[model samples]
Each structure stands twice: as structure tokens, then as C-alpha cells.
Target: MTYQAKLIAGGKIVIPAELRKALGFQTGDSLVLEREGDSIVIKTYAQVVREVQKEFRTMVGEGYSVDQFLAERRADWGEE
Candidate 1:
């Protein structure tokens, strides 16, 4: 789903409603923008959260609980 938006003189572009809906972006939501060569990428806060959740889910496959993992690390470091 591609939409065209114009950048005004102040370098501000209003995101199209359809594009926002497709990206699951809501008003006042945070976004991260990055430049890749001649292209710009915009990601919403929800997108970042989804990516993190996916990574963490993979890391926890048949793994210890949060407290157990922390305790093991502390023991290894000799920090109680």
C-alpha cells in the first residue's frame, strides 16, 4: 500500500490516513526515521515493540525465567 504525500517548505509531511492505518499508527504515536542511501524509512513505536517481542520470544525458547536468569548471571559475576 503506497501513498504519496508532499513535503511542505518546513520539511514536514502529513502522513496519509490510509498509510497510517496500514502501519497501525495512531495520532501522537512516536516514530523513528532513518536514511538508507537515498531512501527514508519510518517506523512506529508499536513496530519497534513488535520486533523486540519477536526477538525475545526466540531467546526464551525452553529457557529460564527472568529471576533465574538474573541469579545465574549474578553468581557468575561473583556479585551475589
Candidate 2:
């Protein structure tokens, strides 16, 4: 669904009530704005986190412990 919103003072735009309700957004909810090519994308924080977690779950790699990863990064830093 698409909706048109006018840019208010200070370049702020308000999300339509219907759209917000459909997306289950409350007054205090947070949204993230990201730039993609020539378009700006907006998504709720929860939505972004869910997408990231889903992507992480699908990733496959050699099994490594936190200590191992940290040690490797520290070595790269070279005796900072």
C-alpha cells in the first residue's frame, strides 16, 4: 500500500494513521531510514533486527568461538 505525506516543518513527514496501525507502530516506536541506490527505505527497528537475525541464521561458515574471533582481530591490530 502506498500513501502520500506532505513534508512538514523541519523536513519531517508524518506516517499516516492507517499505515501506522497496519504496521503495528506505536507512538514511541522507532524506525530506521536507509539509503539504497536512489531510494530511501524506512523500516521499523524490530523489522530490521528480525531481517538481520534471519540472514545470520542462514549464514554458514567454519565454527569459531568468540575468544578465537577476538584473538584474531587483536592480532590484526598488532600490539596496539
Candidate 3:
């Protein structure tokens, strides 16, 4: 569904309340905006983190353990 939004003063665009409710957005929540070509993509912070994690997992291939990696890094830094 497309909702019309107004660009208020100070270049702030108010997202529609219905859309916000649908997306589970709340007051003072952080949003990530990305410019892809000529379109602006708005995503929640968690959504962006999940996307990054998915990409990282694909790049690292299978059998990658984040806990093990962190332990190794801590060992290198002489930390328990």
C-alpha cells in the first residue's frame, strides 16, 4: 500500500502512522535509510543487522562459528 507523506520543515518526512504500526515501529526507534539508484529505501535497524548477518554468513560459507571466532580473537588479545 502506498501512503502519501509530507516533507515537513527541517527536511523531516513523517511516515504514515498505519505504515509505522504495520512495521512495528515505535516512538524514538532508529531507522536506516539507503539510497539505491533513484529510490530511497527505509529499513529498521534490526532489519539492516539481519541483512548484514545474512551476507556475512554467505561470504564466510558454511561451518563458521561466531563464538569460536570471538574466543580466538580474545585469546589473541590476551583476554579470557
Candidate 4:
């Protein structure tokens, strides 16, 4: 779904309501913008959070944990 919006005087572009709803964006929500050559990419904060969560799950599956792993490392480093 594509919609057009006008850029304000100060160069602020308002995201279209339909697109926002489709992407689960709300007022005051954060967004990240990236440039890829001549194209631009925008993503919601929630999407980034979900990606990070997946990465952390993979790390935990690789034998890392908040408490036990840190304690073991500290013991090895003689800081325990």
C-alpha cells in the first residue's frame, strides 16, 4: 500500500496513515533510516528490537547466559 504525503516547510515528511498502520507504527514511535546508494530504507523500532532478540537467542544457544556464563568468565579471569 502506497500513499503520498507532502513535506512540510522545514523538510519534515509525514508518514502516511495507511502505511503507518500497515507497519504497526504509532505516534511518537522511533524509526531508523538508512541510505542504500540512491534508495532509502526506514524501519520501526520494534523491528530492530525483534532482530536483536533473535540474535540474543542464538547467542544463548551457543552456551552463553547472563549469570552462569559471566560468573565462569570472571572466575577464569581471577576476578571472582
List TM-scores for all candidates, in order: 0.68, 0.67, 0.79, 0.69
- TM-score ranking, high to low: 3, 4, 1, 2
Model 4 is weakest, by summed lDDT over 10 consecutive residues, at 57-66
Q: Model 1: how far is 49 from its true place, Å?
A: 3.3
Cα lDDT tens digits for candidate 3, 1-80: 88999999999999999999999888888899999999999999999999998898898876788897899999999998
Top candidate on TM-score is: 3
For candidate 2, the C-alpha RMSD (Å) to the true structure equals 4.3
Candidate 1 vs candidate 4: the TM-score winner is 4
Report the lDDT tens digits of candidate 2 across residue range 1-80. 78988899999989899988998988988999999999888889999999876676567334655677688888999943
The C-alpha stretches of model 1 lying farther than 4 A from their native spots are: 56-64
- Which runs in model 2 stand beyond 4 Å of their true positions? 60-80
Clashing pairs in 4: none
Ten residues in a row with the worst lDDT in model 3? 59-68
* Candidate 4 local lDDT, 1-80, one digit each (tens): 55788979998989888888988889998998879999778888888889887898897785666798789899999998
Which lDDT tens digits does candidate 1 get at residues 1-80? 56899999889899998888887889899998879999999998788899887788788864647788899899999999
Clashes of 1: 0
lDDT of 2: 0.83
